[model samples]
Target chain A: MTYDPVLLANIDKKDSHTLPVYQSGGGYRGLRRALEDMSPADVVELVKQSGLRGRGGAGFPTGAKWSFLPKNHPGPVYFCVNADESEPGTFVNRVQMELDPHQVLEGTIISCYATGASTAYIYLRHEYPLARRRMQAAVGECYAAGLLGENILGGGFSLDVHIHVGAGAYVCGEETGLIESIEGRRAWPRIKPPYPAVEGLFRKPTVVNNVETLACVKQIVDRGADWFRSMGTPPDPNDPRDPGSFGPKLFGLSGHVNRPGCYEAPLGITVRRLIDEYGGGVWKGRRAKAAIVGGLSTGLVTEAEFDTPLDFSAPIRAGCLGLGTGGVIVLDETYSMIDFLHNSCRFFAHESCGQCTPCREGTQWALEMLERIRAGRGRLRDLDLLREIGETIGIMPGTTICGLADGAAWPIKTALGKFREEFEGYVKEPTTV
Target chain B: MNVLDAETRENIDTIAGRYPTRRAAVLPVLHAVNDRLGYVPTEAVVELAELLELAPADVQDTLSFYGFFKQDKPQGEYRVWVCRSLSCAARGGEELLEYLCEKLKIRPGETTPDGRVTLEFAECLGACEAAPAVLVNDTLYGNMTREKIDELIRRVRAGTHHDATE
Candidate 1:
């Protein structure tokens, strides 16, 4: 599997919407090849070997994720592109969508053929108007070229791509949450066990994949899996990135950095390199204070661990941060830990959806305490209350119908544990809320 | 406001036609209306319901439940939506939102009397490290500052920023 970064090849500073240009570069060739030459199994096999994984923050193997669909469940299997990329720090999907939407459309068409799906849904966030426009145009272009809809590319397979925009909700980024939203419900997440593949949107067998993951499939089928594997840091023979980690990943760098945008780099690239080379190091020489590896739900790692290679297992092994959404956020000296945690708690509280009692009450309680501490009203008990709130939600993971409780709980728990001292000091010298 | 012109309606209808289910076209209709009117008004919601053959209540729920739907309230001519998600939050999204409010002399979710700008908070505009970022209507102004936000509002109100219809 080659990591050519060609997916991002068409990006130009002067021209953000570059789908037409991507077409000239043979962008949909993979979809063409699959429709004309291969069977669905062959397409799936190529992706399976390519080691592609879900880029929608989960990192699940793309081939395996598709395989979860029942082989003979029904005829109308569905492919839902999780284009609702609202996870904080994760903006790579939008860049890819805005720049080369045809690539996603092409990949989606191929995926539909492989999974025997006749219908596909691209559930995008409503906030991304430009991306929605680009994607809509690209889908239109694909339909014009006979690469979509009935008898695609004259290959005798019919596929239709629909772009559904979500009202804003971070939980909607969750696969089930997205499914529920597409079904015209409030964007609350549903319990797993029936994962989207089993009973997704309208209770059908569906394959919901991230925008980046689906795009990778088009390239894998076109270039072959071995070439794709060659570009990423080979899994360590001695201490290789775990079996779980594989291939080049698209990293979205943001925060206190000079240059911040999307970059397609190998999975094991160091956080230091991302901040130093790609991010142009910390701004104004303030020095890197802390970094959030994935997104908000991911645990925080301080500057001392910046060199930790960013692989699925590497960050966890470093024991500082959780591999959130592969969104590396660098915070410099100007950041206040107290206010930062309050802001995070507030987001969790606001987005809890109140489905589960623990998440509903606990997030609000935690935010209140964090807010009080930030507002200089912190008694020592406020820190303890924050800890208690985290504990209550921590036990609510499998208890809740969805993982939202767990998602909101994990960060609070991790933050309280990791930055206790900073939180503790706020009890004595709190910053105004 | 029936801000969508005939050509815009045709374009929007084309999107609605692509979906097999009328419910699927909800987002496209809202987008078309928002693009044209700068927000989804009650009239547009009713129009979307008629177009999609769904009840107006259904469209209304969809619009109000989702945070992105800017309703047809008296928004200032320009709106500043600041990102307040975890990534941005961790790196001073709150302070930036505050800075904008102070600079514009309007709290979040409040429209200035002069109709020049309305400042509001958003949940993650997706550019986290560009923390302190704000979306001025459709365009993203990353790495935001009070001065930059003020400059953006002045430019938009002064007819310098690209109009949404463009």
Candidate 2:
């Protein structure tokens, strides 16, 4: 299957970050069309028909998420564009914001219009100083050109966009956590049931969408829903269900790959093709030993599963987790699975917001066991203990306030389950001959 | 000691105006204070609390949650963050960090004797395309080598390196 660059079509153009260059490539047409012609319900229905799913790990339908907002909520409705791309192996959103800030801004404006939101916030990570500057500049440009401020393009829809830079915390990427961070508090994710659509951002109806997810909205509006649905496979075959991971996705390929960068490809493309064709295959002519197909939180996939379609459903059906933010980290023959798992465990342990007991305690205990095994001081029973701890934290959903604990546990459980021998080999008793 | 000058206070007010509530501007105001002063001093926190209409403890609580803000004292002139995450680690980011430590005669998370540079390890700066990346203050230098580290150190010491924020 050939790759079609929808989100990244203008990324390579010179001066692509500027409004003029972006406009030259037929940018902001989505916002203009939606404001000039379509109603809020019409825009939402178009997206629903487009079969667009959230690009931020969870493959939730983008239109469904927007439709959750109450039509006539008395108070102010808010939209938050999640630009905090802190997932360990994910860097695609960074490229989107840095290369084409206006694309994200335009998508966000269209979303705000569809959701009837007057205020929108772009929650950016602190590490991305360059992206923030570009976004700020672009916002200023939009205001000056009558694209953002009052009565946008004389369509009688006024929206104000603000950029909020986050402090160093991985959990802020969570929608509710992001809301909390924007509200000037610690990024502890709030309990749901009063979902963000119902109540968020100072207890107002809010819609929190990822940067990449919103970027897709622009194309869905500009090209129409049929064009959007024609790209990827559907979830079911005869009388299909949800749109099965449709549209072009940005895959951040790194680790041991010859070319480690973000690649734009259609969903359901084979992982082997992604590595062999786009990533230039494994680095130094080494065979791929294992790979973390999605982000660090997703389960590991061995070379035998290399042919698995890089979509939202196939990997989960193949005993691995679903395609997360599509951050693929390849491990070569020289890489150690145990070390990789250890690093993953340490990251989760350090980042588990400590909101729930199972997550806070389980993450720390799992790391200690992994460390003990790594240090060659492991008894045979440590492996079972690690699995038990991981299952306690992750096997059951809603074990923690947020998915951080689950993220911590899935990698450990999957790594141990797949590469138990490698872990066991590290457990050596004193030379008792 | 009135750590927040008139200019910093005015900046905080402008930031507060961007949000519906003044409390929403806490992070940006703290960043403003950090930019003016090397770190967010305790006195500055007290002043910020008063400015934002909250207790000093409330300001301190928010400050403590984040690792980016330096509360106690000033950091070095050039804050060097070496990426030590999986992608960069696979590309020898740990070795580059060690090399920087050896060349500077200081440990990770510690400042140099002359207070010119402070070395630390960052999880991921979202620039995995160029692995083995180093963030000198706000600027990111990717695909770094031992020679690049040496040159970076020299340039930082000479105060000639371009700031990424600029």
Candidate 3:
């Protein structure tokens, strides 16, 4: 590898999760720099200059998101770390939290400082008990070391951080849904006019960022924006607002691979290179048929589009929503497309928050159609009906309260369109359901 | 009768104080009771409602929204969640579940006759690199196999699930 890994550097070290080991490698230097040298506005501007984007599926610019908070909000502001990584085929956040928790904690403190947030909460998934234990230990260490409570390192900024473990609800991974869960309510996502930045987390200004996104915040403070921008795809010169993917990303590899694990690589590596080079090619020397490159929601990638760069913008051109989380699940020749689609659709169907009719009913209906097709009982129009449900259910179609519908829709719609022949083969008999 | 004792009440109070609103303590309180008793009983729900200053129906409403909390009865001491998501599924996760079910002689959501372990299928344990991962309560066991399952079960039966993870 040409470039050195920043985020995952400490993961392999023994006791790397401890505060001493983390500090020995200059861990809190990023927070120290932010608190000692930079003002809140300057810290936010530096992050904006770094061009860091959210790594939790959505590729939104992080610094611009922090700037959305009301400059003079009378009440205390809140920051939420979205550690609810329930996305299938994605587990890098879990690895980060469990192995090198201080980085996450340091990043959280810096994020709170930059956003003027007095309190922060990491909404960790209930399934991640090890991560919770490690993070709890790390948070305790920080408070004891004068890096968390009241005046931090003689800097006047005071911040309180808490870890709120979530029950098993996939919808809580959504930003608004996450806010709802934090408020101790159902994980149903709320409408976005009074966005979380404006009215969120107990009706105060809130900024919800992903784990990887915050790690980038610490790195940006440690190394200048130019150093961070040396790697990754540069922003579009013609398109003014496009903040291109910069810095190293944790692209996780699993399914039909010889060595299944998370590896740090630049953002623009092609899906084929990711699987063959990093993942040690497909196991059993099998040929790759298709892949869900970015979790289940980003849709499937067929052989023809495998060479598409796994950057923020390029995934859409390959028929996915974007490079969501960069979690690649490759399907080899033996794996059935129908079974894979059914499983992916079933995940969304089971996990919908039931707040909207389109997602609640459409996801279930889509699953039924897939089941029928898998059982050799599908009609040709059923495929068209599935496509219709996909088009009508998600945020892209303007029919739901949140993007969960959009996530559910992308793969079902994309798979039906891209793998038309395979789907058509199952629907040979024109039988009514 | 209030099922929550003084210790549970104290824990709930401290948790409620952590958040600005008493309502925000609902999950923490519920999780605490659920983990301790191995299930959130209906009686405990009403008791927790009073503690958190929430209505009984509101508590039940929120509790019902999540899949993790079991209200009917207490599960076994160990809750084994086997991953069956796409990444795990592609690598024999379904078969692994079936194998565990057959060996335990109990289906998903059912505890063993001795009430030692409760079996369930999980979406994804997020340890996908380990492919077919099995989560026993808080600890995740990766790269599962029949031998590992046998050792884990033996350890669980002996009341030492954390010992000899290999």
Chain A TM per candidate, in order of listing: 0.93, 0.97, 0.97
TM-score of chain A of 3: 0.97
Number of the top DockQ candidate: 2
Models 1 onward score TM values of 0.89, 0.97, 0.97
Best by lDDT: 3
CAPRI verdict (incorrect, acceptable, medium, high) for model 3: medium
lDDT of 1: 0.76
Location of the lowest summed lDDT over 10 successive residues in candidate 3 chain A: A424-433
Per-chain TM-score, chain A, candidate 1: 0.93
Ranking by DockQ: 2, 3, 1
Q: Hey, what RMSD does candidate 1 come out at?
A: 3.6
Name the candidate, 2 or 3, with the larger DockQ value.
2
Candidate 1 regions off by >4 Å?
A1-4, A13-20, A231-242, A319-322, A394-396, A431-433, B1-20, B30-60, B70-74, B86-93, B164-166
lDDT of 3 by residue, A108-204 (tens): 8999999999989999999998889899999999999999989999999998889898999999999999988888899889998899999999999
Worst 10 residues of 1 chain B by lDDT: B157-166
> Pairs clashing in candidate 3?
none
